[model samples]
Target: MKRLLKQSILVLAMAGMAGCTTLGPDYQPPEVDVPQQWQSSLTEASTVADREWWKLFQDPVLDELIQQALENNRDLRIAAARILEYAARVDIARAGLYPNLGYGADVARTQSSRNTLGAPPDGVGRVGSNYHAALSVGWELDFWGRIQRSTEAARANLLAEEYGRRALVLSLVSSVATAYIELLSLDRQLEIARDTLKRRAENVDLFRVQFEGGVVSELEVAQARAEYETTAILIPAIEQQISITEYNLSLLLGRNPGPVARHASIAQLVLPQVPGDIPSQVLLQRPDILQAEQDLVAANALIGVARAAYFPSISLTGLLGLASAQLSTLLEGASGIWNAGAALAGPIFSGGELDARLRVSEAVQQQLLQKYLVTIQRAFSEVDKALISSQKLREVLAASQRQVKALKDYNKYARERYDEGYVSYIEVLDAERRLFDAELEYTRRQGNSYVALVAIYRAMGGSWVDAAEAVADKVDFPPQDAPESRHWWEYPPATRPAAQNQP
Candidate 1:
């Protein structure tokens, strides 16, 4: 009997080792044709993609704000948690490759009535007790590579989630910087409004006095008051916009709606040097593209899993234990008992269910493949758009600066002519109005130029992400080596009451 058991175990091991080849298509990364260089014209600016691009702005407050948002942002937190969730799923899928070992004990007492015709003879007591203890092992042999495929799919999903989280980090940093720039530009606009209001108020007092003394007409006083009112109304409008922007920025920092601290005016913020000579192929390395590719990998692996469902599932189960009527004799050799068995279960008929499932998996793979391609295309498109915006907005900023300067000179000349009685105050008001609009536009152009730079960095992903991550929040995975600390899922279903309540 012992030799037979050994032979049986040997035969089963050989069968498992000789399982058929893995099913379904193996994943090979799809090659995408890329332009040798970006379509946008290249510049001689120093490359900033290899370093922390935000620090190029040289604003300490901006740096601190980005760090805070990275650490506290709810979107980033959700993405990080998704990585942990997928990692657990990978472990669960991998466990199918190993046997499950468990121990069980049972104690029972029974009484048979003597009045029953089928009762045991009087040699045995009417009431008796039996005790049994056993160790059991069950393992599903991977004859069709189902478990391997499932594990492969799960691991790919884990990687996809990790990349997704990284993509979120990249987006988070960009958003914070953009919002900060906008807030600073609004601040500059408000400053300009207040200064203009003060100047207009002084003019109103002067024109009213001149009109009372018969040196100027009442029309001049009315025009001065009208200009003063215009500038006065603008202050509150800019102030309201500032408040709204502050509220949006505060949300990014994961804080309550409130004012955001600034370290410099919009004009004072340094313009980051554009990264030059970028190859279009670099878009493949963007976190979103990588994440999409991993999703494709996972989908491809699922085809194998679904295909394997058509084959028979083979498993080995064994038990070795002690059983006896007497507690003290349970440890004796005579009480020893053991059994080994093999099971083969396959779908005899599923009413087209298995076929439909396989079709579904195949369709999903096709969908993901298209999605991956779209992601790559979109990545390249974004880079192109960002580069163009950066270049064109720089030109806009230059022109706006020149316009502001010309308007400033025009305002001065118009005021002099009015004082010399060569022109009406209406010319002065028109020049001042044009100058005020130009000033606001110039400030807005400054902010947009900086924002375009941020967009460029975001679109052309590179090592700067690692540099940013060095200062951002850190997510720690659960320690796998700590045997004493068990996850709720590790507990048996009957023993884990808390698992039912877990999310």
Candidate 2:
């Protein structure tokens, strides 16, 4: 019997190896067109996007805020937890490739009457007891690679989730930097409003005195007061905007709505360098694009799973244990028992359910393929848009600077003409109004230039994102609701401790 059992096992192993044939299409990355060079380029600045580009601003406060956001942001935490979820699912899918072993034991007593339809002989009274115990195993042979295909799809999903986390980190870093720049801009605007208001107040005082001395008319005093009130109104509005920006930035840092620290003024922050030599193919490394492709890979593998379902499923089951009717002889060697068998099941007719499933899988594959292609196209478009904006915004800022300088000189000359009795006070008020508006506009464009730089770095992802994520990983986030007690299957010897929290 032992020899026969060994021969049966050997034949099953040989048949499984010989008949293995994976079904459906294998995954291949989709190819899409890429441009040779960006349409708008900045050739003068060094390539800062290859590394921690946010540090180019040289603001320690900005750096600290970004680090804080990376560690505490809720979105990032959710993404990390999703990665763990997918990892567990991968293990669940791979489990089908191995045998499922279980144990069972039971004891029962029964009483029978002679008058029953079926009864024991008269010599045997009516009461009886039975005991049984067994170690059983059931395994499905992968002749058509259904389990392999399912495992493949699960692994791809795990990769996609990992990339999704990295993409969130990239976005978080850029968002913190952009918000900081905006805060500085608002600060500068508030300063401009206050300074204009102070100067206008002095004008109102002087014009009133001249009117009382009969050197100026009441109309001139009224005009001066009107200008003063206009400038005064701007101060509260600018202050309100500053408060709103601070509260929003505080939220981005994953803190309660409150003030955010500022290390440098708008003019003090260094501008980030825009890298011009980026190749079009480098966009493939963007985490969002990579995540989308992984989704496509998983979808492609599901088609194989659907196709494999059409073939026959062969399973082997075995039981080896003891059974006895007498309680005293339950464990005796004579009571030992064993059994083994094979089963084959296949679809005969499912009312078109199998056909519909296959069609659905194929349709999902097509949808993900289109999404993958569209992601690449969007990445290219973003890079081009950021590059063009960065280059043109610099020109806009420079022109605004020139406008402010020209308006300052105009205000100075107009004031001199008014004091020398060569022009009316209206001319000086016009000059000052223009200068105030021009200064505010220049500050706004200055802030936008920095924001454009952030956009370019974000659009052109590279090794820098990995470096940022490394910093984020240093903070050991709590396990996502996973129990501290772990099963043997959850703590596989093949996986590293750093891979998951098994216990």
The lDDT values for all models are 0.83, 0.84
C-alpha lDDT of candidate 2 relative to the true structure: 0.84
**Candidate 2: regions farther than 4 A off:** 1-19, 476-503
Error of 1 at 41 (Å): 0.7
Which parts of model 1 have CA positions greater than 4 angstroms off? 1-16, 115-117, 473-503
lDDT (10s digit) by residue, model 2, range 1-503: 35544655665566556667888899887778888888775766676677888888899999999999987787877776776677689889989887787899999998988887888888987988899988777889988889989988988888787778878888989988988999899899989988888888888898889899999999899889998998888888888888888887787777899988899899999986677777788889999998898899889999999999899999988777789999799889877778888999999999999999999999999999999999998999999999999999998999999999999999999999999999998999899999999999999999999999899989988878878886666552336566776443233222326645221
As for candidate 1, its clashing pairs are: none
Residue 193, candidate 2: how far off, in angstroms?
Answer: 0.6
Give per-residue lDDT, candidate 1, residue 184: 95
Q: Which residue window of length 10 is worst by lDDT in model 1?
A: 488-497
